[model samples]
Target: MHRFKTLIIEDEPAIRKELEWMVTQKEELALTAVADSVAKALDLLAQTTPDLVLMDIQLEDGTAFDILHHHPSPAFRIIFITAYDHYAIRAIRYGALDYLLKPIDQQDFNGAIERLKKQEVAGLPGRLDIARQMAIPEKAVDMNAQICIAATDCLQMIRLADVMHLSGEGAYTKIFLQQGKRITASKPLKYYEELLPGENFIRPHQSYIVNRQYIDKYLKSGILVMRDQTEIPVATRRKEFIINCLTTLK
Candidate 1:
């Protein structure tokens, strides 16, 4: 098996140590270098060319984007590590880049590495550009904002405004859009509920999240009628809250 040369860039002492241990534990990965800040990462990048870079979003001096901006054309694949920046996480998802949340789980880390190994390096620069653009707070929640859906075969970037509703199917999410199109995303509905803007999207039930723009009417009998004539059940506990929300929208 070919071992990929890996570099870790993280500022937090505990996280950096944990990441280093994880990388070193993987037989298919070779720990080439580690950096605690953007400057140190840039310096390491100049000295060694790693096959994979596991980097955190925020560093001591600046963000990981700072390093990428300086090195316009990088040869390595990137897997972002973040604690919880809504815009940044959305940006990474929209760009179709892999990411691991802070206090990383070993299983998730391994899965990310395996997925990176299987993916091709084509179109990375363009994806990175999209990430960089969407990372901007103002642009992230705009009308033209999009979310990347990981389908079985391909990644689909769908405009937020185009999404009508999302249904949870165990571990997956079924996204309903205009023109009767549907996408089965690998992520769960809860993932989207948190990622989407709260002003436009609302969770009426544990298994369903609907876009306010697509709602046609809410019946007093605990049902929401969508523009496409789909009837979504409003949980009994959420009836009052949902009704108030719809009333407020009117």
Candidate 2:
């Protein structure tokens, strides 16, 4: 029985503790070191080479990219962890690396571990380049914009325009699509709210962010009617703003 040495780099204490607990649960994984910042991560990397690194894309001092770039030829497998952003997902896919969105699910975690157990990593430079480009904070052109949505068995790509609405349940969000389908994503509603095109999407309620194009009508009862005929509540405070956004869209 071989145990893979693993390092976890995350800033949040609660998240770090949770990851530590999860790592302990896996008999095949051995937690070597945990660091909260890029500088500390570098020091740890210098001390011991881990077989796998569970890194947070965004760190306090610098990003996980900084650490990766520091090591020209990284021998370890990297599994990026982040809140919920499409750009990071795209980069991870491009790099042939695995990623787990925040509010990590046990199933997804197990799946990623299983993949690492079987797959041989290749194209390190290419993947790293894509990640670097993604971290630059530029909105991708609409036509080229693609979101990697995680499902039970695989990652699916969906167009931005096809997303009808998003509903939040604590840390997870359920994305409703125009094709009468829904996918549960392991990211918070706030994550998608910030990632989606602002001009077309609006946070009508704390639990819901609706696509303006899919909105059919706004009822006086502070409810929005979707093209799919789904009734989503509009926050009292955001009613005026929602109405205004709808008016502009019209």
Candidate 3:
């Protein structure tokens, strides 16, 4: 019986140990390398070409996306491990990639491993591209990065810099982009609030989240004047928080 050479990339000490133990339990798997940060992971990758990579989404230095970006076409299969990051998990699922949430369940881990053993590496690059585009970084929010938006007819990839504002309409979100382009996303405003980088985006009202870069001015009468000339109301409770965020930007 041939054992699959596996590489573990995780930062948390407890989880890392648990994963190592779990991998040891699997007779088909052989733990080849373990890395706690992006730098170490990269160094290990340069040295070893493992059959499978168990990667955590966020590391001390950077994200798993950074690692993926570095190696655009990796030979090994990947099973992403992350916390309850709605956007990251959603992106992985959207890409049809395997992911195990934190506090890893034994059954789920077994299932993901079984699936990986059965599947082929065909179309991995395309799936990875989709995952990279849609996965949001937990620490650094890059304004220039592109995010995948699920529209009614199709999935649209929109750059974070091009987004002007987001408005909530019941369960859906209406994304206002540059040059008067708008897209109705299947997800709600709260989903975007969590996904978007807080440094560039702010929730001035429950119904609206505006990009700080596109704000023309803040009115004294509890309103925001956008560069596109759209007036968005400010919630009474969020007024102080919004003002503080804007002040820091200036």
Candidate 4:
């Protein structure tokens, strides 16, 4: 009898530990490699395609959304474990196979496991059919899952594509957008570097990744001028790259 080898993709340390406990408590299931973030999970999946993946919807790097793109399982079976309530019902109705909400009971878990066993006899849904249709909300791009920004005393909605530049101060990243609107968030520049859409932004200074579309003008001395006349001090190291980026325009 082959055991159901499971891989857990979760960011929270305590949560990951509990998942390991859940899998081990079952006689028919065995725990496999655990990943702390989506990138690590993607790498591990390339090497060891587990029979089942227990995923947390919210992750440090991004959401468990990318997993659905794999369709059934890559190895394809997926069980979403989320704290958010509404997504649970959506997960099941959308043919996700199953979901386990937080504060998980042993009985509910055992039931899901039994369902997994039952599905094996019936054959699982072909994940390929659903994987092809995974489309994100397209109004504003949020590939990194960084949505709301805290500005002054209020939190404001933001789209990654609308942000024109990220300027790093001591501990905060000042986000400059296309409409001459600027906001500051408590997150660091390194955090934005990981969260921003990579191709659309280019770092010309230690404090900046000027959005390519918003570069109003560049002078002979390599100073960047925004449409609103906000002068961005470009780093000496990034002169050529910035020049090339501006010069190669259609």
Candidate 5:
């Protein structure tokens, strides 16, 4: 691995020193610059982009989010630092390798550093906008429980919500929406599980996917129900997790 260089963008001197100590302790990393404000960070970025940045969300001038908004990376990587567990900050952190919540846990810090070290910025897949990706299907993709389908051609666009269940058709997948609208997607069922909002869905089998809101009731007899009364067989082993997720809705 190449020697990783780091920039610490933090407002507090004590925290900055602590981060510098941590970085130097790791033989692979070199602490290059410390900026208490975004202006200084931006100036350094203009001169040279570092391998990684240990960035605090709130700065004297602006947020790390603001910095990220203006400058994206691979030329530079970010490890967010925040005192709060705000969801908006979390979403941004997800786009990067990791984050260090303030009073950073040593274990999490070590874990984050380890993750930053292993990353091949080029290999991590580029991001997909949540709205655009969700729009690939249609109607209630964001919230509202309406049936979702975007018909753009001669062929019908199947409503995702109408889906009774999803089943693996080999390595590919089939969407089993109501009124017998079964469509095939090149992606795997696991892909949809991650993309879909968890509250509205469930993974009952390695080969099958389910929508929890459509579930009528579950029976220990091993069958799950849908709005149309479609019966989906649940893999006994997957029942616990699926049951727990479904119970969260109630």
Candidate 6:
């Protein structure tokens, strides 16, 4: 088995250590080098070409884009690690790049690794345009226009408007779409929560996130009925927030 040659670029010591340990845990991933600054990252990249790079967007001297700028067309794949910045996330989404929000979950990290493996096998193209768009975001791809779902067989891109809701299935997720199409993805629901536009989707329960556009009505029994007549239970704790979201939409 060929393990992925990986590089870690993070400034914070604690995060770097955490990520280092995490990388070590994955037998299929081999840690090639570690860099704490953009200059160090660039220097290391020049010396060797790793199959994958886990990069932090915020560096001491420069951002992850600085490293990307140094190598316009890089051979390796990139998975951006960023703090919660809505604008930056929008750019990443439009650029069609994968990202993990701060306070990273282990499962999410593993999911990203799995995604990188798929991208590598499929020779996924770089989304350097997303980094550029973060600076001058003009003519960005519409957020609600489409969504990419990782199916059992492959990555499937479908219209966001067609999705009715998402159901959590432990490590996987079941996406309910229009025309009664249901696809199972190899990632958790939290992954979609971060990827999807906030305005379009809302989590009514720990197990369910329903699209606002597909909401038929909120039943008195504390269930949300989707356009496809699927009854999604509303968590008692999330009921108020869900009501507010529904009210705001109206």
Against the true structure, whose TM-score is highest? 1
Candidate 3 deviant stretches above 4 angstroms: 1-81, 85-100, 103-140
Q: Tens digit of lDDT per residue, candidate 3, span 1-250?
A: 8898999999999999999999999999999999999999999999998999999998999999899888888889999999988778767854557889999999999999998887667767767886776665453555676666767655576788999999999889999999999999877898788767677889999999999999999998999999999999999999999889888895
Name every residue pair that clashes in candidate 5.
163-177
Ranking by TM-score: 1, 6, 3, 5, 2, 4
The predictions' CA RMSDs to the true structure, in order, are 2.3, 7.1, 6.9, 14.1, 9.4, 5.1
User: How far does residue 93 in candidate 6 sit from its true spot (Å)?
Assistant: 8.8
Compared with the true structure, model 6 gives a TM-score of 0.65
Q: After superposition, how far is residue 92 of candidate 2 from its true place, in Å?
A: 1.8
Best by lDDT: 1
Question: What TM-score against the true fold does each predicted structure earn?
Answer: 0.88, 0.56, 0.58, 0.48, 0.56, 0.65
State each model's CA lDDT, in order: 0.88, 0.81, 0.87, 0.68, 0.66, 0.80
Better of 2 and 4 by lDDT: 2
Q: For residues 151-239, what per-residue lDDT tens digits would candidate 2 score against the true structure?
A: 44455567667788999998888999877888888767876776666777889999999888889999999999998899999989998
Error of 4 at 128 (Å): 7.1
**lDDT tens per residue, model 1, 29-74:** 9999999999999999999999999999988799989999986667
Winner by TM-score between candidate 4 and candidate 1 = 1
**Candidate 1 global TM-score:** 0.88
For candidate 4, what is the TM-score? Answer: 0.48
- lDDT, residue 238, model 6: 91
Of 4 and 5, the candidate ahead on lDDT is 4
